[model samples]
Target: MDKVFLVAVGIGILSRIIMLNTDQRQYPAQPNILLSQLVLAFVASSLGALLVPALRDRAYTSITFLSLAAEQFRQVRENRRDSLQNLEDIQLVKRGEAFIEEIARTYEIRNYMCIITSLSTIGLYYLIIEELKIAKNTSLMISSIIGLALTLILKKLLKRESIGDIADVEIVKISFVDECIMKVGDLKGITNIGLKSDRERYLSRGIGIEIIPKDKDYTNAGILFDSGQRQTIVYNLYSRLGLYREHDEPAFVPLPRRNPKKESLIIAFIPMEKDEQKIIEAVKSCPVLASAKGKNLSLENYKIGKKGSV
Candidate 1:
C-alpha cells in the first residue's frame, strides 16, 4: 500500500515539472499552457489524496498500541487511582478509539470525493481556457492554493479528535510472596482480580499463579491463570464475552513454572466493590471448598499452610 502511494506521488511530481517547463517555454502565446497546468495540478492533488486514508489508519493503530502499553505500565508501577478516575480513563480510551475509527471512515469518503472533484474541476477549467483563450495563471494559482488550504484545514480538524488525555490511575505495591498467594485459588480454582472500577456487578475472576526467581525486577511474582473454566467464569460475570478491551490485557501475567523447589504463590487484589450474590455463587462453585461442608479454613490460614492438605 505504501509503495503504491509513493509511486503515484512520484508520477504526479514528474508530470507537474514537465507541465511547468512547457508552460514557461510557451508563455504569453498558448492558452493551452494554462489548461495543461490545471491538469497537472489535478493529478498531483489526486495522488496526495491517498495519504489521508493511510495516515488515519496509522493513527488508529498507534492509539490502540499506546493504550495497551499504558495499561501495562500502570500495572508495573502499581499505581492506584480512585475508582471513578480509573473508570473515566477507560471511557476516554473507548471514546478515542471510536473517534479514530470514525476519522478513518471519513477519510475513505473524502478520498472518493477528491478523485471525482479533481477530475471534474480540471476538465471544466480546461474547457474554459481553450474556449476563452485566456492566460489565467493567477486564477489557476489561486484555485490550487485554495484547494490545498482546505485539505490542510480538514487534516487539522481530525487531529483534534484523535488527541486524547490519559487519566491517572493508582498502583499498589506488593511483595513477590503476596503476589503469588493472591494468584492461588481453591480446588475448583478461581482467582478474583481486576481494576476496582471494573467490578460493577461482579468481580472479574481468573485462575491465579505466581512467577518465580524474579530476575528482571520489573514486576512482582504475581500472575493470574486465565484459561478454560476460569476464563468463561470471567466472561459470564463481566458480561463482556469475546469482546476483550485493550486495558483488560494487562490485568494478568504469565507465570510459567521456573523451579520445582518453590512451593508458595503470592497474589494481590485491588480492593473494589463486588456483588455479594456473584461472590457467593463463585465461592459455592469452587471445587475445593464446595464439598467442605462448612469446614473450610479462613483464607489467611489456607495461605499459611496451616490447614490440612488438599
Candidate 2:
C-alpha cells in the first residue's frame, strides 16, 4: 500500500507538471503563482493517493477530505479570476472577461485532473496486485504505463480549437482615408490619426489583417461578432508580437473591428517587430474560446417552416 501510494502521488504530480503550460500568453506567469499551483497539486495528489488505502481499511471519514479539497480548488479559481481582473488595467490590451474566466476554470480543472490521475494510478495498482495476483514488479510497470497514457489522453481531449479552424486570416494592405483616417483593406474609419507624426508612424509600421469566417452558414462570423472574442484576438496579437506603443500612446492600441455586412473581422496594429507573417501566425494561433461558440443557425432541417415563410 505504501509503495502504491508513493507511485500514485509521483505520477499525479508528473501529470500536473505535464499540463502546467508556461508561455508568453499563459496566465499566472509570476513565480509565486506557479509555486502555489505546485503546492496545490501536491495536496491534491496526497489526498488522492490516500483514497484507495482508506477505502480498503473502511475509513469512510477520511474520504470526506476530498470535499474539502474541492472547496479549496474553488477558492483557487476565484483567486485567479480576481488576480487577472485586477491586472487588466495595467495591460496594454485587456484579456477580456471571458478569457479570464476560462483561465480560472482551466486552473481548477487541472487540479481536479491531478486528483483523478492519482486515484486512477492507485486503483489500477491495487487491482493488479491484490485482485489479479500479478507479480509485484509487473504490476508496478503496467500501472505506471497506463497512468501516463491516461494523462496524455486527457490532455488531448482538453485541447481547445484555434482561430485558424474557424477563419481564414490574411494580411491586407493598410491604406489611409483623407490622409488621416486609417483604412485596413476595405475597413474604413478605424481611427483618426490627427498627429502627422502618428500618421507617418502608422503608414510605415502598420500591419493589417482581414479575418474571413470559413463557415458558409456564418457560424464563425457569429463567433467573430462577440466583443469578448474580438478582444481575445487583439490581445493575442499584442501579447505574441509585442505592442509598439508607449504607455501614453492610445493611438497605437489595436482594435479588432467587425464588418457586419461582410461578416468578417479586421485589425490594424503596429508591433515592435514589423513581421507580417508573424502577425498572421499570432492571430491564427489564437484559441477559439469555448464560451464564444455561436449557436448553430444552420439547423434548417430541424426548424419547421412557417406557413408563409420560404
TM-score of each: 0.25, 0.91
Q: Candidate 1, 193: how far from true, in Å?
A: 8.0
lDDT tens per residue, model 2, 1-310: 7787888899888888888872224442778877887899999999988998899899999878999999999999999999999999999889999988888898899898889989998889889999899998799889988988988998888777778888888888887889798898888998888899998888899888999877433567777777888988998888878888888998888888876656689898888899988988888888877788855466322312223323
Scored by lDDT, model 2 comes in at 0.83
Q: Please identify model 2 stretches exceeding 4 Å from their true place.
A: 22-28, 215-217, 296-310
In model 2, state the lDDT of residue 97: 98
In TM-score terms, which candidate is top? Answer: 2
What C-alpha lDDT, on a 0 to 100 scale, does residue 129 get in candidate 1? Answer: 54
Clash pairs for candidate 2: none
